[model samples]
Target: MSATARVLVDGLGVDTVCALDRGLSYGDGLFETIRFVAGLAPLWSRHMERLQHSCVRLQLPMPDAALLLHEARSVVGGMDQAVVRMTLTRGVGERGYALPTTAHPTRIVAAFAAPAMMGDAYIHGIRLRWCETRLAIQPSLAGMKHLNRLEQVLARAEWSDPSVADGLMRDTDGNVIAATMANLFAVVDGVLVTPSVERSGVAGVARAEVLASRAAVHVGDISREDLLRADEVFLSSSVRGILPVQAVDDTVYVPGPVTRALQRHWRGLGFPMEQA
Candidate 1:
């Protein structure tokens, strides 16, 4: 943790995690990164909904939402802007892959200073590259924000050029999945389309909000060609709100009307997307 960060383990202010925690040992956990603006988490409900769903899927006991939020708020301390990352692990257990007969889930909520606003990227759009590292197909873990993120870590390591905002990743089958950290969307022939996360990738809270909007968005498979030929492209994430894609590799894109409209919509929801 950095000097500007505060952490709470199980509702107590703490700076260290137990060495034997399952999350550290086996990556057996789920996490959420929430954006807090003016002491409130605008997408808090969506994040909690996803976390609850993942807990049920992984058979981990769901923590009380009110209690969790209380702890998260306490750590954030009413910052004007901040990022709250909450992790829930199966906790200490006996050696090996066996699940403990009695499980005590460890809840860690950490708050960090929000990243500086990406003004130019949000307005003029951003450049991206294609990552050689591909996501593995794991239907069981698909759409869950599990602790296992070696693939994304490797993909992000492929680039160090500050000009490149992020890298687009593919699944093992070579289908376009998502950016290293954000959900992807494209406007194909005036219709909005986003790749299906059923096979791989996270179903981001920002992406869900876009889908819930009045815009008719198609959720399905998307290929490299699909994006290259699309009229517009953008990436969505809870922290960054929405960012238009100016280019991917050599293929160029103009931030289209759809992208701008959504940016306004996102701002209206209390997540800032700087005006173009």
Candidate 2:
């Protein structure tokens, strides 16, 4: 997993970095996992928007966008196909939860090879297990992909079933939110419904696309029973695109009309299925 990376910090904007940044220390930062297409990010605007939203919510200063872009290009310049991870921190705040009044935020942009291809999800669906760890409902940081992801990490670690491609998680109130790492959607009576991310779950880019394309997308509190009784289920992420879930618990479902239509739309958008 060794790879080249670049760092910019503390207004000086030098590349060689120290390990003492607060982003690493207290997870007191925000980040975005961006997909660079043809040496460009098609969804760069969305990523930036989300990053800005996260920074405001976290009370962290927004770093210089032009510098961040320049650093990102440098990081991605040396890689063939890459997923760039940009991290912004509170910039070495004094040792406490108190915010530094005027410290510059530390920024790091690291690029690495895109995930190994897992083949066509449209033809062959993936399996998912229910995660035991329920999400804590935090409306304040609900939809942004913030740094505190220990809940997902723990949920993923609960099972070593490599057969299970991912795990679906619910919140403490039994509201089905999303998978351990991705957003979920279900087709109920020809309608595409995703859990309302107003309480939890990262509002994924692909999920936004589908909701926009298919105007009737319902975002509301969904229960596990609602998931089980649905006609079809699928997951979406920036990297994974559209992944149909064949089985959840003992009940199973094929990729139904709604999911298939969404996949078609997603392909037209840019990220085609591996088989397509």
Candidate that scores best on lDDT: 1
How do the residues 64-158 of candidate 1 rate in per-residue lDDT, one tens digit apiece? 99998998889888687889999999999888888889889999999998877568888788999999999999999999999999999999999
The C-alpha stretches of model 2 lying farther than 4 A from their native spots are 1-19, 78-80
Give candidate 2's error at residue 234 in angstroms.
0.8
Clashing pairs in 2: none
The most accurate candidate by TM-score is: 1
Superposed on all Cα atoms, model 2 deviates from the true structure by an RMSD in Å of 2.6
Tens-place lDDT per residue, model 2, 172-201, is 999999999689999876667899999888
Q: What is the lDDT of residue 171 in candidate 2?
A: 95
Identify the runs in model 1 with alpha carbons over 4 angstroms from their true place.
274-276
Clashes of each: 0, 0
